[model samples]
Target: MKLIRIFFLCLLTTNALIAQTISGFIEDASSGERLIGAAIKFNNQGVISNRYGYFSIKVNVEPVRLMVSYLGFETKEIEYTITKDTSVLIKLHPVQNNLNEVVITSSPKQELSSIDHYTIPLELVKKAPAFLGESDLFKTIQYLPGVQAGNEGTAGINVRGGTPDQNLILLDGVPVYNINHMFGFFSVINPDAVSHVDFMKGSFPAKYGGRLSSIMDIAMKEGNLQSWHGTLSLNPIATRLMVEGPLKKDVSSILVSGRSTWINGLIGLGTLISNSENSTNYGFYDLNVKLNYKLSPKDQLYGSFYTGHDGFRNQFKFDNSVYRFGLSWGNATAALRWNRVWHKHLFSNTTAYYTQYNYNLSQELTSEKRYNATTNSSIKDKGVKIDFDQILSNQNTLKYGAGLVHHTFAPENKSYQNSRMDSTAMNTPVESLEWSTYLEDEYSITNKLKLVAGVHYMGQHVQKSYFHSFQPRISLHANLTSRSKAQFSYNRTAQFLHLLTNSSLGLPTDLWVPAIPNVGPEKAEQWALGYAFQLNDSYSLTSEVYYKNMEGVVEYTDLSAFLSATNIPWYDRVTVGKSRSKGLEVYLNKSRGKTKGWISYTLSKTDRKFASLNEGNWFPFKYDRRNNLAMVITHDFSSSKTLSFNFVYNTGVALTLPTSFYEGALPSNYVHDLNNPLLINYKFYQSLGDMSQRNNFRAPAYHRMDVSYKLTKLKVNGTRSWIFNVYNLYNRQNPYFIYYDQQKLKQFSLLPILPSVTYQREF
Candidate 1:
């Protein structure tokens, strides 16, 4: 029996020796740099290298052709014969003056339309390193051209010469007002719950209604079809927990995610234990939930809901006693959606949603004298839309949709100066109901020529204000060749609401006001032309120029009227104006295996002509910056690890600052009497220390760098992984806001450099 066992062991050992693997390393021929994570494919099998640029794989064939590819490097295929299972080395040469890769996502069988230029995938979102492991839909799109990030911590995206508000943000076909949590440092969408994001910068599709400048569509995850999956994350400021699973075999699924800051609570406890007065406290929390079910093979149902809140507190210590003050805000949203495929060529989707936002402030001085005010707002949008998509052929397609929306806008219930002021003193709620119908056609005239055209007719009725308007859009694409294309687009749009703010800082005082009878709907006309090219399979480049003309824009005569007055409509406190913007955008992208990154630069100018100010001459817009540049790169050391770096440099944003100090606008005794009812009017005479232009002065140059590293797929048993990330690695101070205090006669900026870390686990 012992002899038989020994013979079996010897046979097993011989077989193992015969199955020895072939391994090798890849490096850049020019720079001689080790190409970590380079893809090596042979015999229908592929494997990525480790950080040491080493790879090993077993194969039956002794001789095979190995295909090696990496971004910015020429793809090479080498044939080598293996003798006695020996390791081999390969080198790849970098392509000189290679064109960047034109990475786009679109469904198969759909005609490629110029209007639908690019589609970003959700997997890329999850893979990309983000702030605190939090994936932001808007921030991810900034990597593309025609999109710019205005400030740190702010999801402000300037696209095609338009402001952030101009971009229509939609979640499952429902509009969302504020997409920020914790003021603006993070986005509201939890990466674990998102399924896809589709953004269009230039051309507007007929299937989409509302918003003029751009469209951002987000689709939430439809739960899991398999068993169950969950993740838990921890950071210095917050902790997050999420879970997803199938309710039934393959019919139903659900996902839930929640995050909350423990810093404030933990710090508060520490202060209490030490018997010390609390000077500052900040806290934020958010929740997200999604569910999906398959009613039939052709029908599906989904529901999504989100809520978040932010608060800050401070206490002033005096010799006699302590004074406490606090400021807080909150937002909530919920949506339900239904999608049904009528046939192989027709598709439809329907949605309903609701959203709310509120702010509160409270202050106490020795208890006897206290001030408290709470302002709450809610915009309930109940709507239903039916979208029909037909594929006439491989070359012709049509997408059409119609929707009806009922808006109930509730302005804040204001209470001021302690209990002396009542909440009912504010204006009554305003309700606007609107309905729109639109249709678009995408035609491929030839293999090299494509066109997209659509129009929308909108009707709004509310409080004696009736508006009927038509928005038209058209885009053309001419492929110069397989590697190049030329495109042009023209669009017209109208807006029925406006945001009135005193400063560019976007303070709480900034009010979102609806259009009234006196204030006509804002109208705009925009045109753009562009060229795109692809070199090899790893590089893509694009250049575009755009122009926009707007009229009937509203500006305030006195910033205080937007806050002090009640019962009066927004038109009574604002003045109509005109504005224009023109810009050029250039972008390049390269992504393959180990190294992936892009460079984006924008040269633009925005100007406003306020007939009521600056003698009607055009001046730069408050948020405009003449030039902006950004670069980002990511390197994969292995299949489970990566490092990301980002750098941004831009010209200063337009600002308004006093040229010199002065006592007051009025110096003569009769000047005050002459304008008794008007306070101190400076319209008739030149100001003493005026800056000449409201946005003439430029702020300091803006620049910053950030780096992060991700570690994933740590295995113990089953399907489990881990991720670690750090934001603002070098701690570069990216100024968010700069304001001049009248009392101190000095400028103050908010938020210095900040560092954050997060740990995550997935199953």
Candidate 2:
């Protein structure tokens, strides 16, 4: 006991007496925008940069060599001789003569070998063929190994059997509620204003929470600090513009971007040109703005804002009566952040943010009798958070944070007419409080082994009930050889809110609800094991296997349950169940040279069990697919000419369909005998999808090919490019959905053999 105490004392005293601290920020040399996840190594030990590019570590208090590296950026080495505490700035330049490179990793290393994480380069995705010439961030990720899309040309993604709401999508460290537009046909995020995206499907970090399946952390460009630039782009469906410049040369900068679709505009114009009273319009628009200012070398502030809206209106006029209908949904979010380096060893970031999502519907009719109806549903959150990173020594790093959020939920359903009304809240307008705190440590046990251990505590209070959770996280990494690596991780995630979906169409009518007494919060546990090998200097391969289990998930009993049964409480109408998923994924990539691309494959299974719905039997989840494969290739014929191709194939998704026909029932107002004078003989039949077994029918297998070509010309002062693309080049009429019509099952497809062209100008 005495010797152990003495050794611990010596370990604590060694750093204070013999070592010093060195800290600084890493940034891009040309634009001065901070880089996230940059690596700094000294004597073979290192730490990664934070969200704001701040990094700190303890030195030996003697002359030493420091190395910094980031993907797609040149490596830098500095010779330091300082003996006490000091701070400095390090800048790295872009790689010479290399086009955009997709790293596809989350580890804080110089290699593309991360476990269950991906870093997607925004520019590289722009080179691929897009839907209607609009490059989307969400669609790019759907091509990964373990991700699945719900339908053809839809932006919603299902990760590892989890629902779309299970993903926590953030923009500039702020939460975004609605990620879809045009009834889930396209995503609302502007691709040009984004810098990059970090997607983590396994190994949850300590500072992230409120989701079960994945985390999408998106960052905005900080604008160029040395000059001004602008871009204008046009396609058949939408128009977009972006501008960025230095507000005060070197201290401040601003970026503004906006995009609007013209399909609905043209529809409205056509109706006006014909002087028609009846018209139909549908449109979507989004805006992004960002600002940053440097108060000093150690202090900086940033502000980011985003707003997007989608609206649909249809009206019909006949005689003296008119019917009108409108539906709209959108998301608005803002975040303000400050970064301060308290000392050479500690870095802190403080953030305050606000986010809201809502959908509204109105319908009215005028005639001898008047009818009107409206519904407004919304959810809002206001929160503040502070995170800190402390480098203790060469072997130990500490990370911790705390946050509090205020939530307001309003699920209102009301309809009134000239004579009667049915006004009742779906759930009610309630305010709640949510708070969380976490602590974690990343320790290098040996020169070739590392471990990350953490704990998180969270709680929520709504009405007269309060619920809390305790979760533990762990990760282990080993360098098996100079060219081989392996990793293992475990994560527990919980969600306090739910999306009440009554339709598979991803409509705006979906409602958001909080955890009630009977229905607890949704929880998931996942474990992953991965191995990687460097096939050569140009190619890399990785294989991963994962298992996940989810509990306390709730769903509606029927498609029309929402507002259909007002007498029964909403909570009572939902049924709670559990799910399980397991999968194996493989990926291969080529990262260097004029031609680069990747191939990915996944084999997976998922099922669910509910006592009330499926007769206590386990059945396949909607997204359960036995196989998925994707391959992509990009070739640069020259600097002025580039081409890309993508091919995707996946097993058929499961569906539910009626298998038998039943007899009709007599109408209430009809008699059995046709000769009766008082009434007539008639029959009425009612039928929908049978829910005896969940997802027992499978649709046809899906496969498609896409291609894009870019031709560039150098202008006198800038550059001009023309992009031509084709979607579903083979004209395959793949099944988007299955419907029973005329007593027969039919296949429906939305997009087929589409080709588009876009023009872009940059100055």
Candidate 3:
């Protein structure tokens, strides 16, 4: 006890010796939205802002030059005398010329201190050629290396050979369970309401858990602090409107945005013209709102909510019978958060959130005896998290956090009714509790070398069983020269939930299941090595190689039924396996000038093994591709007009098919009737097919080109713009899927040569 007391006393004495410290928050000057990953540099010491835009650093008690920088923002520099503890709020202004381009640049200090992180500006996302005249953020992200889209025009993404469920997507500190609408044609996020987006593929920090592949953090706009403003946009597929302003001047603010599709109305009009007996309807809508309040200088409060729904129905009547089919799905999320500046060198944030996702399918038959059937599935999450950031000294920073979540999983529920008073109902719901705590330290060993190390401990309780994991993370960065750096990282991650999907089309019927006693949590260990160099003032290059080993991966058995209105436990129809993936990626980016964009390429291989499947042999994963290439270029013709082009080429995905067929005969017993001198026997023969290994065949290569043009006009009230987009500019018949038709294989395509237009107005 005496020795422990002495150690703590010495620690306190050392901390008291520090004479100066600087701490504050960084935000956008116009929108009041917090900026994550902003760099603050002074001499040989620096620190990046946390996710909540808070930062703290200890320095010498003398005059110094401080620099603050972020992507797409003008750099800010100031001279300060750090004589005592100080606190300040720093806001950065947007660059006028680069307002419409997605700016991704690193500060001189951050260039050598960070790795495997990308910042995508909203303007750049809007410039990409839209799919069906709708600007989609997820679609733009798919153009980057190490990421692939599931279908021709879908928002589903597979990153580094991992499924979509492996990525943890957060919107304003709340997780979004289902981010797709209209059968994956578009994402649930409204681009007009988003302020900033950050993506991390490797070297995950200890504060982020519950996912294996990547993290996409999206920050929403905090409304305009200056005045009231709104925007209205229209296209063939959908229409969107956004409004934002201060409720009580600078003390409080509110923002609201909503989008809805008009395709169903157009279809109804067409039906009226044709005078058809059949009717079909489909539509989707989403709503988002955010409110912010400043109670005091040291305290702030925020509330955010999002809700979206998709519905489809088709009905036909022939003779005396009527058939009807319907499908519906939606997502709802809400979050409440509080920020506090506890001391000059310490900051904290606490958040409470709730999210729910549900989908249902129904079928009805109208006749003398009516019959009806329906299937439904849902998942819900409620959690609370508290995080703290403390600046111990100039060379050391500490981060720690803890969170608890309650998950309710309803994998499936079915009901059937008949006119004869016969009915059936099946409902099964499972509940679980998950908790985690993590701690990390960022230490500068020298002026040219730095290290970030951390550990996360997780515990889960479900079905009268308990599971725990200890995950470790480490990253190292070494400055080889003034303009080049080398980085290495290793991370172990754990996932307590899984998504059971049988189709590659990304349907809403996919079920989300939790880990139980019989099924274990999925775990992965990843290693990455990278090198980055600043070629010149306007260009940069980065290359990385990575490998991952995964265990406890789950897949459905051959006998498992999907989208069935039956009562069966999900856990009884799955098999656990193992997987591995390795890849190399190269990217070159130009951040300035009239012509700006990026070129990226990737080479990868992924395989899986299961003891009970594929004759115990290894097979390629379904989404694996050998090579991928992408190029995007945008040229500004003038201040009012711009042209952008994008090209992509990738090897086709792998699939499994039958190789041959054979005949089999069933045995039958023979009864001998000696007296009658006759014998009778029966036998049956059936055709059986032999299948090859899983994902043993690859489809044909796929490629496409897209181009767009934007024209802008300045108005007294606000701004107006017109955009023209052409998908599949070369008219390439890219295959969406391949299937066997009778004796020959056939390929089906979804989208063809298409052109669309959108008009926008802002005030």
Candidate 4:
């Protein structure tokens, strides 16, 4: 018995002596900003850095070669032998003299391994040609295949025939209810404050839910841990600034960025130009703040907050009477998170978040104060979620999470000063609870093939109504060769809330409705197959074909009913339908060399059918186009000078125009205007007539070219740059909308040839 005990003890001691735990953070050497999704490998085994730039791996204590690689950065190699557990920070430098260069390798955990995900590097966002002299992440994403932009200069996104609201956008693990500012011309997010962006259109993992078409996960910079840095940028209409520094050296950090317009005192440029007190001012401002503190070697705490406001105020004074109209919309979000490293292979993150979006419109009369009124719409969300990542081995990794969200919605509320009509509210204040849980596993069946499978269970509760769904997702990747690959994926997604718009304009007042007994949730299933190949070491080509089917999509049955005098229940004016979308996309990108660019083309078809609309026949979706093509190029002239060019061509959107008009009765609530007693609210206030079908006509094709030149120079304390941008360089008058006038069909364009310049300084 003594001899057996001695043998077991010796075996245990030997195992402990051989195993070693190595952990550290990966960061940029110059900026001291931690890098995410970096790959670290040794002895044919590897691990990826987490979202917070932490990594841990267990390995033998013998001498071995360690390699670290990150896109757009120089890879490093080291040889080391550790006696016990070791912790070290890995710093990487950006490639010298060239910022547009990008390279992808067939690493085991590269972005493409997920089979349809895209990891857009931050450098690309900074180098792309800006719209109106401002860099926009959503605009850059719209140039990708399978994604469509709404109107000229609009930041609205429609992916794979899905509406803008259908995309689940996240910021630091918290949802953003609204991403629009300046009436959809600018997104709420400040590009300089973001660290990384991940976009997925298909084959979504179980960790994501509540969206049908796409997911955009954005990570904010965690502040510099070594030193302090700040940047200030200016444009013709807006200015922005960013600051990041360490609160406690190597222990805590903070980052703050703010953007506000200051053109003649915040959009009073119009008043300045006209020199009148009866002018209008419209502008927006955004603020972002984040703080991080290390509680221990294995635990960290984070807090982030963001708020943005857009307001339009107009006042007109005529003699002794005054008329004022104001419109405002804003969004606020906050998140508190805790990150813990339980073991070398186990990591967890717990987060509590709150988000709110609100819209307000008011009109007042000085002479008739009793007629003053206000309209408001709002939505709020508070939720807590926890996630765990368990790296079992090199062949398998398990991910699981659960969340619970309490939602409050006030669709639309109208208040009047007169006591005769008290107040009116549509889809009045309602409360709901959303609960979800997910589990997934990534298994490497072989060195050439990988399989990822997951399941998500989500449900909603509202006033004795319960809606639930079990969504399954799967993806398969096969490496055909060292430089070529093939992949296939299938995904099922569901949404418990719906955004209801009265018209195709997609105004800020669009109502948000939860899943009730009268209306069910929206669900979608998608299948995609793709192939990718690398040519030489500078270029890559990827092609994919996909099909999607969606059910429980809600649409307005009668717009006339909405304009009636009496209020109508939302469910009574809407009906459910189904939609089908299929598409083929081809993309070719250049990664290295003096000139970098990409060319993408897409062919797609989307149709919808309703039992009570369009005579129960199929019709094209309003935003559906048959063909879209885009090209982006950036040329490095020298170390301090660069040029960028962007071009896009899209087959026109589908629309319906009334061939003729017929006289119709006005709404009962419409009151005559004393200023123009004979004139109506609109010239064509009569009913729409001679309309053959919905989405039966195609608008004219849209094509535009933009160019920008950037010159960087050394400033007093930092670096400064001037960006000269010319929108519509060739002066293409693209169609923004079509209208009928004097029995003639006319096309209306929104923008003209415009040129703008921006100056940026970094210190």
Candidate 5:
């Protein structure tokens, strides 16, 4: 028995001696900080570290290379093999130069960072201060070149001289019809629900269709694959909450976020103070929710639902309620995505989604004892899309996709009491459909030359719509040196829908109407060229010039024409026109270790020509501004604190305000006129008129400054630190809009400076 035991112990010792083992401690070479949760891989077997930054793995084959990597860090590989148990330390350098470059994290985890373009990283975007403590996606994007904010508080932006609607906004790959809420005061997107934002401003790939200017792709969080984390915020406008965590260890996860407004309570308080029971009550609220589930490493399913409502009630039961309006709009989207890595260099993401948008309004009267009522209008849209991206090689990449959109315009319900005191009703129904496909390729011809070219073909089948059209685009870039580059781009785009609004205010009455058989689509062709040079690591200079020509544009004729049975042919009520825009943009960026900021200026002109107005002479558009300037700055007080500030100065927007009165004469044949000549109508302010067009009038010069501070890296008990923020520190009155009351015959300007504070915590 002793001899048998000795033989077994010898066999066990031999097996242990032959086993191959590898271990390492990963850390940052610059900071000398251990990189916890760093990934360490070898051949086909690998293991990650615990909180202490130590890892070990056993394999049958000898290790030829060891790769260690972490987010925002340079990847490093060591060439060695472990014949027996061994411990090695690995240090990785920080990629400083490329750290601020745009990254597409929506792609598969393997090579997502490789899909590179000129982008503003989220880290840099976060450094820019916001208004009312609310950080807006579109507002932040305006800091980058090739983008311009339209109006105050509105997320509307004009990219490369394109109309606001020309840019397509996508959420989780689903197209969003309208990206603005609260008349552009806020973006439809809830910042808490978004993980990454990708905006392609210059050269767009073929996979993205339906828009001509640019594409804003917003990606939601895939949930926390590691552990649970949550955030909550309370601000003047609204309160928000979010939660994300792993569903099953490291395999599955889920994410949820929600927000609501307390404006109703504010409205109630105002009513009580006035002590008027008949006064109108106005309030607005919004809600957002999103869910994501990871079925496997190669498959993901996500669903997002949003709903919002606004109402203004003016109760006068004894008499007629003069005006009562309620407007509501929202959408729901569901997407199922399948991602597969065909090879080390090729990755594929296939997605299918359903999207919708809706709007409704109703008005009634209790006075006049007559059933005088009108259901203004309601619009519904349904769509489906498919997108594919192909990463061929390091120098060349391709994208192609297709989609179908169907819009159903509900019949407008109209009722009015005629001279006989009888109510009459009429309805109008409109439906339109569109399908499109595109292909775009980005190629690097040489070390210094890059070219991006693509074409999109769109077909429209309108049961009651207009003609079919296509959009084409191309962009070229040349790296004169490592810090200086030159770029040029040309694009042609079209819009098949129009916004019918008489008031400049971005109100809900700004009806969206599709092109019909008689009315043609609006078209635009734009060209731009720019040059950039870096003086040093702290300062860079950029300049760009552009020109655009627009055709088949329409402007409102009758200021108060109701679009209903009375105006069966709404197209006839619009004036046909053409427009042109030319502009120059110059920017200087200063980025250093402790301080970062940018200064930008724009000089632009816009004009319109119509056959029926000004004898076909070109005139200025109302929104034409000669100059605009913005400055943003950020200072890092310490490793755990930051201060940010923003200032903007812009020439006033143009408007059509009444100037001088004209002389008029009363007809001698009229009963009241005893052969008397009276003052007649006349054109006003011709000498002072800068130009004449939809955007010809300009307001006073505008300027405002805002500031915010953040405190981070604190530990309260076992939880993480908090981020405290304050916006509009000095209370600058930024103009929201201007109103002209015809009855009062006076112009009134509205301005309000708001401030807010919020707290954020991460674990």
Candidate 6:
């Protein structure tokens, strides 16, 4: 037909003569903030920046040259002149003698655009290496490579083999259910108020959903709109303070931070040097806040809040014969956000959130007739979200979102009292409704392939039980040259809450439970395969291979005693299972020269099955570990000294021991008394023992090493620092639990060669 209408009018006149476009937002010229991944480039095409810093591109040429980069910032290059479609706002700069330079160049541009992502850079999570001197971003994400760490100065995490409530975590975008504090040896994020940390682990982009393995967003720190600042810290078990200013300078800003725990005044001065009358106490505290505004030039607004608490107390007296005990736990969150840009290729964000977690316990008794007890548990959430981003040219880009939540669970609530007045109470509250929707796209099918697909849908209602899920995601990349690349991913996740821990020690009497109608929701399906290169210019290397598969998994019932259960009804004691895991991970980063760190490894296997556990076969999965290793190193001996080291090794964890013992008997009509014929009885029996199957045995191979040193000075009203640490530098006695007592076999160890110190100041 006339050469198919002249090949569709020469492809619409060559896309209307080279369609042109460019878009932007990437600030931080001195605290105007914004700058989420930054790394735009122009002719050879590139893009990165989203998570609120926006960027879009589509060009044909007309005086172009644009570059922009980030990592300690400072790398811009501009030229532009694309006639009719453009919008810009670039600004970068902050590399003034970046610690006396030694950077060797290796801009992996945030892993060349995600697929099993990772992005830690808040100054390398505040220069890594810390445990008691605090700096922890979940303990530096457990030293990377498929994560795993929980039990040994905990900061719980266990990605590839899942657990730790299947990882969700979020902070500014709210959703943080007990990110730990004292009991986990600290981790309530306060790496100077944080400002970036991504981590995805297995391509799951469809705007994320309930969690089934990983996702840790976290982003805070939007203060200092151009001046006012403050900081102060001290450690040896906590103390901190922070502040930020400019409540209206560049159109508003605010930030506040707090932390506490002073070893409870050194345990009340060791009970006044052991002159005690019986006493015990513990403590924890946290707080953070943020607010920002910029109501013009396309609008913006934000507000965030966080709160934390932990407490414990015990007392006993001789005079009136009394005893008492108490325990507490906490978490709280809030968020509100806005942000708009409706044009330059549409962008929008809107959110409203609230979260809460709670726990409490108490006990009391008085000598002659009086007793009391109490317990409580809680969880709550209220949410709203809407997100969008579009840009349809230079090879597509889109993202969409929707959300709704309202949950309120209260797994246990009990009360009892005595004194000839009797009383008892039990309360169970559960209410739910959750919803989700998502969409994703990021095409670019050429110039070296790329594709990201998505879809997600979810719905859940409790009480009368209802559930739905549809997740599907996909990823791919290929660029076998120019520094290498190759990736692949697939995901499918679902979770309706479940955390029923029975000790790996991160305690708060863990329990979160949901999913009813015979307990359901909990599913995963992962798959990953990756490779990244870049060997020089300051190294880089990646490697992955994963496999998941899980379904309904939930545990607890082995006669359920999750920390002494009470008043029953936690889905009638849990137990629904099936699990599987597979792994092989490796990472090697180096980032630049004043000596940087990274080196991770993992090789694994996990298993589980349950028709009711054990006899259904499959075992191992008490954090099954086959091999795992980590190493981090840092060195910068000038520009204010520094040194750091961390080492880890694992391959042990899988326990369930008992193996042999016997003697049973008792019960011959209650020791023979059948109508008094020959009333002769003799009874004494009971010794049982014999465990052997589930999680068979293992637990002995762990290693640890840590070291740190830092010093800085230049205080004329500003910097000052000192940090020194040595947590287990060489005292290798790792096992943290095992017992038998009188029949031998005991083990138990928790942190030993400890030494810590910290002090800081900034103004």
Cα shift from native, residue 445, model 4 (Å): 0.9
Query: How many residue pairs in model 2 have overlapping backbones?
Result: 0
Whole-model lDDT, model 3: 0.84
Worst 10 residues of 3 by lDDT: 677-686
lDDT of 6 by residue, 1-763 (tens): 9999999999987775677677878988888889887888777778777888888787777788888888777898999776667888888988975653422222237434663677777665555568778888788788788888978878889989889888998897878887787777778788788777788878978988988999899888988788888889898888889898888888889989988888888998999899989888889988898999999878889898988888988887987778888888989898999989888888889989998888888888888888988877888999988889888866678889899999898877777787877555556578899999899998879878888899989889888878989999988888788888988988998989898886744468787877887888998998898988878877878888989999998887676855465656777777888899999998887877788777889998989898877878898888878898988878888878888788989897988876766766656775566665433332224445677477787889898888988888888878898889888788999889877664567789877888888898888
lDDT against the true structure, per candidate, is: 0.67, 0.84, 0.84, 0.83, 0.61, 0.82
The model with the greatest TM-score is 2
Better of 2 and 5 by lDDT: 2
Candidates in order: C-alpha RMSD to true structure: 14.3, 3.5, 5.3, 3.3, 10.2, 23.7
Q: Global CA lDDT of candidate 4, please? A: 0.83
Candidate 2 lDDT at 295 equals 93
Relative to the unseen true structure, what is the C-alpha lDDT of residue 538 in candidate 4, on a scale of 0 to 100?
79
lDDT of 1 by residue, 566-597 (tens): 55655577888888888898878775546877
- Which regions of candidate 3 are displaced past 4 Å? 1-18, 105-109, 420-425, 504-506, 663-688
Per-residue lDDT tens digits for candidate 3, residues 619-663, read: 898889889898888888876788988898989888777676566
Candidate 4: which pairs clash? none
Supply every candidate's count of residue pairs whose N, Cα or C atoms clash at under 3 angstroms. Answer: 5, 0, 0, 0, 23, 0
Worst 10 residues of 1 by lDDT: 102-111
